[model samples]
Target: MRFRMILLIGTSLMLASFTMPGPTTSPTLDRDLEPVVVAGQQMPSFAGVPLDQLFVYAYSGGTWHQIPWQFDEVQDSTIVSSEDGLLDADDQLVFMVADTGDQASQEAWIADENSRQYPRYEVVVTDPLDPSKRGWVYVYHSATLASSVTQDYVNFDEVQALVTSDRYLLGLMTDHPSMDRLELNGSGVDILDRTKIRAEIQFLGTYTEEDLEASRPAATRDGRVRVVIGSGDLIAYRSMFQNILWIDLTSVPMRVLWGRFSTDLSPTASGSYYYDANTSSGVVVDGVSDSVATSPASDWAQVSGTTGTMVRVVDSTEAGGTPSTYYKDDGAVDPTDTGDQRSYGDAGVRLDDPNRQFTFRTWTYVLPPDQPNVGATYRSYARNPLQAQTNEQYHPDFATAPPTATSTPTETPTAPPSMTPTVTPSATPSATPTPTSAPTDTPTLTATPTHTPTATTTHTPTPTATPTTTASMTPTSTPTDTPTPTVRWRVYLPMLRARGSARNAQNGLVLSACLVLGSTPPRIVAEVGA
Candidate 1:
């Protein structure tokens, strides 16, 4: 008995030890990674470790430098600047927001990049936006931290300043019932109403977990604000109007596409950006001014201060899918790769994480003087230059790639705007049965193409790529002015098939039982029904 008990205890201990999480192993980090500087270069980098965050490095004098503000917890934090050139050597205020229990712990500091030290934090009067709540926003000279409950806010959450040459734009969110937008003047806080803003957009739904992690909302270097809002799983973008000429980041979609915006441009509010998951590089807009749409249309094009370079967010994985693999430059989707059947309109390239043994180069495209895709496609590639540059000043081993050949996309015919799928009602006796079985009669999908300004084309083509096909074509659907009443039932067959043939058989059996019992003689029906 004693031996058995000891044996059982030993087994339990062994099992516990085996089930416990193993000690964290050192990750294969890509330490040799450098920045992609210049406008026309496309280089690629690879990594084994997941990209935590990306930071951009600038060369000042003979040394490569990143601002000290990018660090977190004695470790390297800022991969790239959220908004650069905001704080000068003297004209900026800095502070930290620390969460302490329910009340926030905020400390004001004077930031100086020259010195490794900062002023001792002075705790100012704490006013809860809600007296019943605990979180608070810490205001500084030219910056602000809206929520100061914990260090996680600083460590993980994207913090950026929405500043122009004169004023700072702030986004305030609180648990209270009333406060949404509150503006603070030198003396007191005034509630600012955005009711007159004609272009305001509300949340699509709650943000998905993946959306929250991959999402980033950026403002232009000039502080034209953009905020990515993820409500539910659906992702959309909104941007603020740039002096009524272009859209600001505040008016852009607050989803994954927003994160694809390159950190290179200021007033990055309205430009279209791409994210290539395959290469893992940020999309760098070339040759186009901040005001031009990747297209020629006003819907996609906006005017801005910077031309010849810009960055907007895009995703090749979700947007380009199979075509993303052909992108060759700096891990970005090669705009000229013939193998790519995906439309470049919404697709952007992605960059790999940086680690040792990894070398990266950056290339930009030299767009033709005229919108090459104009009239033939939805967007024209006229004014946007495609050449890229790299910051290999830190590492000298980077390789430069030659430009690839470009191909024009095949265009699809336009469908009538009202030819969309709609449910029809029918009072016919066979309507229910027909809808339950007909699956092929469903209406087709057609996207209203978004036109870019630089695109020479008169109309923008909507991408038609699906999981099964690589080409972007317009969805082919049955053409009819009006769908029959039974169309609604037929459209629902795909969903009904999930119940399986057994359930369908059971339903048939019940129907048969009811029909026969009702139609047969009483004595015969009673005998069969029993």
Candidate 2:
């Protein structure tokens, strides 16, 4: 899920509307947790479907059950529901894979709305990367049962630019490429050391350096966080600085200091541990002390601290593969000042090949630490995402409809032709579900005015590694959760033996009652003819 890296300036003004960017889209988030998003343009067949008559349904347990869905209409940059009730290029369709799968009941050949459960959710890992996995959902245009109710898993606070997911809370920073706050949802453990989580850049032409700040919130959509910023703060002090833009080998959530997962705040309840793509076993990073410049490059990472919770997020770039875990060199800093951190573990990359512009995509997730599956196959799958084959076919209900399953997605997406600055950052309220259940946030798109409009750039120092610290990967164990599998069913008919051995319609589902005689036994039955 590669998306353009953008930044935005935040203001106290709450957005009047929400979710939509200029003509562009962005920021592939929660590959493991976010819902599946399908834009109107991607599915041409949707053009003729009336907005009010549309519905979303996930295939599971052999039948077609109606699921909840929302139609977010777009007017340039902001989201408006049912405004025009049209499925246009500016609009999108989103739904959770949680309620879909290749699983089907033995009688799937005949299951229908009358036999399926309504408002039930299913949890299945349908990542197309797993070659053997079969996963898909359906979008239907119905005249009779278009859902009248839908649920929201993610929420964004337009003014705070804070994204509250099911598992954690993220507050995007406007002053730099870092966060103002990042906390585990229920534990109240703030993962980031808020005082300073910033990105400093180094340009080669003038050999000058400057700190970049967000320009505005660009795109606004659930499961997508986007902001618009330049190589340097384009509106502040360093206005006359060099035009040279250096694509440092890395650029991601360059978090800061002690209060984070480092030595000062390591989780003690169940010991501390971390996981990375570089190794099969979990590394221990129980924050007993500080370390710097850990494994330089790893595609994915997970951590847990005092709350006994495990959280993970990945950072990658088109310019330099996956971003590395590196740090900036700050020669002068207090060893005791937790707020003024100089060297910290950065998920962002430091590009060896500099470029003026490249696609940078990343997102963090707070996985529930309630699972007993640390050794499960999914962890291994995360380290190496394999490719696979898919065959999507609708339930018997839509027997005439074409199969909607798609092929495996490419690791990196080709940016849309119109690079109209993808939307801005995401946000949320403090309350939400765990990361495993999925969460998201979308702000009021770029159509909303920004708080700050300066054009001068800000100063940021060059990034360098601290030679003395230990590897950032530590050895320890963290907690996790395994979601429950949901199976759907309507009626269970017992196999009635007849005539000393033969069975009558082993799968009995009589369409109507046919008994005519009222015997002395005077027995009666229900409508299902059970």
Candidate 3:
């Protein structure tokens, strides 16, 4: 999958605009004019008061700190001079509009009031011409000013635009005081080091007096993965928080090898003769040979040499082709078995056939766990038994050939022939077995037999074995079970799941932010201006 890069440009715009009845007047300043009007009406309770009767305060470090201010007597507006550098970049200036006529009212507001009998307004300042420049001011009634006053310092629209433009975003929202230390300790930043994948990082819902709110309709609302972090143990306050990490894997093309098998004989019949048939009339025909060897010559000699002067013969009358049968000693069968025949059955047949062929096949599929909407492909291969003996490698070619046979023989050899042919029969001229048309290799990517997703912690999932195998070549009378090859790739994606607790929430926030931002303890100090 691919993504388009987002570019952002900053522009300057009008600041705050609120209306209230006041005498129009303009203020005189000592410096060059780049005046930013901070005009707003005072709370109705203090409406009739003169501009000199009201004082403005800035909230910083959890306390309302006072700063020098001047009122615009002409425009009838409040003005804060930026020439003295009182407002720095990225400053969450919480200014309170105080109607303090004396020191008593100021002290009461400083002590932190329980009720909101005072009026206050919050504003976030960012230079439109330089969106990165952060500076802001707020206003509240002197009587209503409290330590616990809700702080609305972050602008949701601005943050969403900034992060989405970069394509990938990761953020943390927590009220934990230990967050700064955790960043330094590498609790979160270390995870990012494990991979080279890059993403944009932003701090959200931090330093605001309000508990983190759930803004579900924001840019991060769709296709977002959330992880809750915290200690499971019970604590006084469950500081639960959320960490969101969004990645676009469409650009990351994952090539997965789905399935593979070598061409070879079936597991039970490999390295052994396919047929052990005898003529209707028992006859030991010497020097009979098959066009092809069923078992190796060494295997046939093992039985013939043991039995005195046993002969090999071929029957050309068979429909497909002449198959080799062997003649052997009568003692090949157990003496207690009364049904056994010494002349015509197992004991006197050819051991190997050269004209026979075998086919082997295996199947597999590839899937993306997180992106289910995206489709995946299936891979498979096939080969004949003889080809499998030499080259065990599987290819994508959809040849109709059988899977390669196992290198190591797994089946036991059948018991040696028990009975000898009673009559010596003449050998008929042998005919070669006609070759059958090869099966067409049809490799299909269809998802037959749905697969289950495997869980893994690593970025790449490990391949596992599947139980499906298809082998063709074994005789119908004597069925053989072939073990299917087990070679398939499985993908496991990373995920975090946790219950919402206050402690966990704080941990989640710090951890999530650190993960996205790639900031260390020292860097975090600069990030939050600590």
Candidate 4:
């Protein structure tokens, strides 16, 4: 592929000419981002709206671009920024959801100007006169944050423990989780020579399974440990527009398995192992059964060096983990498939929590191995995690949020005088972006090498359009309750069996500046963590 994109831009300019730190014993941090808001009472037209000009947007294909919004301001619990500027309430209008599936595997979250793919979106708004469907994500309130979008597709380098994304480069086993090698972004071939977690606690009196010969839980009992996410920061949450990679191993300490109590008068029934290491090959992560999953849970492992392929997603199993009999591809095994089925199993992220501690919220994906339907771009944003709601008014704006998309209207997007409309009072993020007729040198990252991924990939909503008198004013009032961001349950839940986390009776979201002026204005690139 063009010499694998010129050896990944010459190994990313030799990884931006080095800077080191992360080996382990902690502190490599940077990417555990988590904080996506829009409050100011959801926008009473954003009342005064000026916390450094505020901006955030995601409504793919058709229009309404502009992504990368940060304005922190937590106060009391730390994160300050009230400088009187406006955008108050608990202040935080942060933003992230760029799990970079690039608009669900190339539907074009724009591909020029700077690069675009505003991923984490879900809007179905269909009342086009009542067929009755609901769920929307179109909040455009801005002072100016456009040029189109791109920045934070996760090139994160925490000292090269690396967290790259355009699809894979990852290598950090620092602070553990079965990753110490997994290259596959440009055929650089590393295809995982590591990754393990085959726990087994047993107990409850003579817990026999023919005496632990790889004791179930997808067997491989303690098959060389791993399934670790970081805390205090090993990357707990990242955002490329919901670019999911959150593994809150509840702040460290995970036991692998340690059996011994045949009955030594039961010293409080102990059996500790908590991650020790055993396996050497690679791709261990076992656990399978739950009637063989559809999407509520799943676990299965198989990999034998093609030098690539790592999707790795496992979630919220405070205990009893297992699902998926097999997925097959890299090495497809089932010699007589003995990884048991289930016997109180667990592959990773299983907690009995008596200090046996375990917590692993999931979402790990890396595409770019020629990019041709890598299992539908990680199952439409890594097993569908959609459920974001807030209302005050979007005034018949763009619509469509199904399977991953919607209808079209085109037009409304103008503001390219450097995004015209700055309230002055800057708080950072103003480098380059006053370009206009774009095309500095063919960028838009070619979007992970031009789209093909399809297992559904919908989302074409561009509704209103053509407007522009500042997008014909539209902003209803009434919606109090402090910035509203309570649409929870994100251990990556396939949209909770098709929508069931609830949050759409209007909680908050107001920025009716309505302006999509000019074209390709979704790239302002300023992730100030604000």
Candidate 5:
């Protein structure tokens, strides 16, 4: 947004009619005396009478003499002089006016004796050519008060003074209560300092609504200044005003940085780490990296040197799944690598210690390559042991008892051989019928029929066996567990690829690796880029 420019021109001249030398022996009568003219430029006014009215005064001999003046509409200037020799060449003239007609009603102002308690007024004059350039003139018709009236509004000049031409300015307007709360909370200062952003705070003391609004037009211009109102409900005001950035100090006590990690690990391992660009610190499992390493490794195999603070903390190594070891620097130090050094520590005893055993270890050095290893390979090995044992026992019994003999069955008298069988059955029936044989034959036939019916009923259960075969098919669901590893790899491989891509995008500046020794505190192994 652009600001309008205004130029002010003040013209004071001695009229030719009043060129006669002063110190006239007799005070010139009203008829012979000529009026002195005072002409100046001012913005058009819509104020009510008496207040909008302009009056001129001349100062001489430590006393002020009021002079009648007429405003010219076409010239936009005020003309003043006196006919009773009151306007002298040695006198100084000043123009006075009220900001509004309401000030004219004050009793202290109307009673000339109490003029010392009258209000003060500031008259603003703008350049006719560039109206934006304006100037203020203070006018006092009575004795000056000990304290001047506080201005409720801010002008364009005030804003221009607060901001630098090249930098962005954030202006905060708040009341005493809100400012006190902010200070007690001790908030927002750090964020501004870290970002190197400029901000100014303005305290509003008993300013009216109109006073606040009058200052907003000059404050809200975009690119010139960003205004934030800290007291009232910012949401309500933000919607009401356009191009003004409103911030609620009570709600947002601090500035938070929000960003997305360019690289993320899948199933996130325990020792995995990331660096915060703003803090220049690496985040590890134990906490932020105490030591910072800075050097470029020409290749992945090259161990770049690092320098910073270091602390000994316990780290669990994936190698043995044990915490019975500590990390010291490996003997692979390079003379050129300045700050790179080793850290050493002892692993504390475990409950299952057999010999009060303790182990000491050194830190391993590894650095990221100048380029990502896209076709890298990894290998792992596993082993299992088996053993078997057996026992045998036997028992024997010997016993040969007496010999057994088989006897031949004798032929029944039912028939001599074949014919005797048929004749015996007929005779046996006939014989029994004579007494109870006939009843026995009928019961035997009835028993045979009942056995046949029971056999037919047993066949119904044969179809039930088919459902048992279908039940075995449900066990197929167990195969779902087999795909778990596949699913894991599917999810894991993409993350690795993404991480590699991110590293490559950075020109292989970041290095991610696990800490050596199964029992050292987590540390971020970072290699700075050249």
Candidate 6:
């Protein structure tokens, strides 16, 4: 017993020593930054009253700390001020409202390692229905300020806390059912146009009366929204908090579900939630529910539900396409698993049902470590397999409404000439051709009219049409022309089941460690045509 104990302790030390450097070791500052706003410079007096009293937090030493890092050693003495309104300060994440004196716009004061202020750098925001009622303020940095623009609407209460990476100011907001992402240029001052930016939402729900009031939306660093529903379900909606179009999930059947998404999508001590397949309910996202892990200490419970059997992960149908599954440790997955469940950079769980016909309409961005500034990306899969029982094809639908002449720019112009860009302007996303045609009615399985009974299916285009291309020019300028961007589409398929065309198998999709359910033949196919 003594020998066994000693061996175990030695192994433990080895593991800890290998992992400690990632989270605890201090990263040397790449360079110094100056604050965005300073005093009496057409910027608000943010240092007054409530602003000065608000506590400041920084992510350093591998954790968020209340104590500020003293930068006296790196402070720069030379200060430069310009009439164009540049305020500089020491390194700090600052929040402030813009100054029109008595009628000011919302803005922030960011200080760098060297105490210099960058002032009057207006923060872009969404516009409101009422022109007089300025929407929520979206704080950005001087570098990317000019290129970013404001929409007509914003939900101030749903704003996510801002986090800074070395070069960007990320504005996180809950666009209700949608997820929102906004970028700030880190190099110089520029204005952001409201028309060029968009927020994406993933889930659909109607806030209960109580939730609508108490359950305000919160933005995540990764561009997703986390909200507490009145039902205590603790739901997350991905998108911007401005110009939110809430989905009424009350009538939708066989809702596509998932286990709780942990911060960084890894297991956490705070615990998580899952969709219960047995009861068609929701349960805690725990280790015990997982199907294949032998280690009790590190296991997460499988999401319970009768519908759980239908939820399976699949493979990507094309090259350079994202793996059917997302895994942790690295992007490489074990090629051995027929289901293609292998280790990847991070892991994500998928939920589906075989009994009820389901469809994957859209996906929203989840939060990541360095977002807004750095940006976040995620993968989504096809509809539930349960829905496939009735309709042989449960793939993603990519068809969108026809592009209206006014919705999309006909010609690429150098900039937005003289016109003030509109807020939350609508764009027409072109439709991707479907196997049959986009489903116009509810999905149902019926015998074919031919004397020979066979599965007669109606195929729907996956929801992949949206403006996702990165804007080439910085958002800071009021351009003389509006450059029309080329649109693209993407979709996700699970790797847990087998069926349909084996061609999908060639894609050789992979999954994460925990998600690796011993290989199962491909049961479902997720198709996305751009």
Q: TM-score of every model? A: 0.19, 0.48, 0.15, 0.22, 0.12, 0.18
* Residue 251, model 3: Cα distance from true site in angstroms: 71
CA lDDT of each candidate? Answer: 0.19, 0.32, 0.19, 0.27, 0.17, 0.20
Off by over 4 Å in 3: 1-35, 41-53, 75-115, 143-530
Task: RMSD for all candidates, in order, please.
Answer: 27.5, 30.1, 39.4, 26.7, 51.8, 29.1
Kindly give the stretch of ten consecutive residues in candidate 5 with the minimal lDDT sum: 479-488
Give the per-residue lDDT digits (tens) of candidate 3, residues 74-111. Answer: 11011112222222211111121111111111112333
**Model 5 lDDT at residue 128:** 21
Q: List, residue by residue over 397-492, the lDDT tens digit for candidate 4.
A: 114221312111111111111111111011221121121112111111111211221111111111111122111112111111111111121111
Q: What is the lDDT of residue 230 in candidate 4?
A: 20
**Weakest 10 consecutive residues of candidate 6 by summed lDDT:** 386-395
Kindly list the per-residue Cα lDDT of model 2 for residues 192-287, writing each as its tens digit. 543232222231111101122323322333422211122111101000110112122111112111111121221222254555555346544533
List model 6 lDDT by residue over 376-426, tens digit each. 111122111000000011101112221111101111111110101111101
Candidate 4 Cα errors over 4 Å, as ranges? 1-48, 55-67, 70-86, 89-277, 283-346, 349-360, 363-530
lDDT of 6 at 142: 28
Query: Which has the better TM-score: candidate 2, or candidate 4?
Result: 2
Model 6 misplacement above 4 A:
1-333, 336-341, 344-530
Query: Rank by TM-score, descending?
Result: 2, 4, 1, 6, 3, 5
Task: Identify the leading candidate in terms of lDDT.
Answer: 2
Model 2: how large is the Cα RMSD against the reference? 30.1
Clashes of each: 113, 59, 63, 47, 16, 130
